[model samples]
Target: MQTVEHESFGSPTEIREFPHGHAEILNVGDATIGRLVLEPGWRWSNDVKPIAGTESCLAPHFQYHVQGRLGIRMDDGEEFIAGPGDVTSLPEGHDAWVVGDEQVIVVDWFGATDWAKEPAGNVAAHA
Candidate 1:
């Protein structure tokens, strides 16, 4: 048997909004993908930490930078900047922010399913 599925961010299955960014999620086959649009000044530690209720981003992401720049700092103090056409494999326990004044757009192949959602059984824990 063969199957093909098509999905688009234009009509995402879910949209997760945070302080300075949003993630549009799509479910195609067994994969959950996300298109994240981060405005300038959007920082994972400052924006998504509250909703995630974790000290750092715990979602391990394999993403393609579509536009703008994104600065990432791992918990181990490693840092780098990703720009358009860059592909990044980010493990859990890292903080990221948009670099410069350009809005950042990324397509995440991994870690989108629960990227900005609260942990299980901890609704509004940081509110």
Candidate 2:
């Protein structure tokens, strides 16, 4: 029997911003999907401000909004809004930004291997 407690990991962390305030974590597991809960006023950057080697490239982001609102916009003038219980697949080379004063919890299903490439110091802040 094996169990991994969430609190055992200490605090939530932020990996790095890509584009449009949307940050990401690499090495996201395949069996266990990455979960992200955004609080009120929680705004993520998607500009890839810190993620190295991604400025010229794009990240493949797929997420589902459980109980809040989320917005995704790409550099090519593409955008979309997601609400509670909404499942969405973000287009490659785009940015995602949260909205509203509600708590938004997004369970990312891109596998657990994705978060392995996040920023250290700023990681917990992204939570």
* Candidate topping TM-score: 1
Instruction: Give the per-residue lDDT of model 2 (tens digit) for 22-50.
Output: 33333322244556655665434433324
Q: Candidate 1: lDDT of 60?
A: 89
Cα lDDT tens digits for candidate 1, 3-117: 9888888999999888888999999998999999999999988999878887888788999999999999999999999999999998888999999999999999998988887
Worst 10 residues of 2 by lDDT: 21-30
The CA lDDT of each predicted structure is 0.89, 0.52
Cα deviation of 123, candidate 2, in Å: 17
The residue-level lDDT of candidate 2 at 57 comes to 19
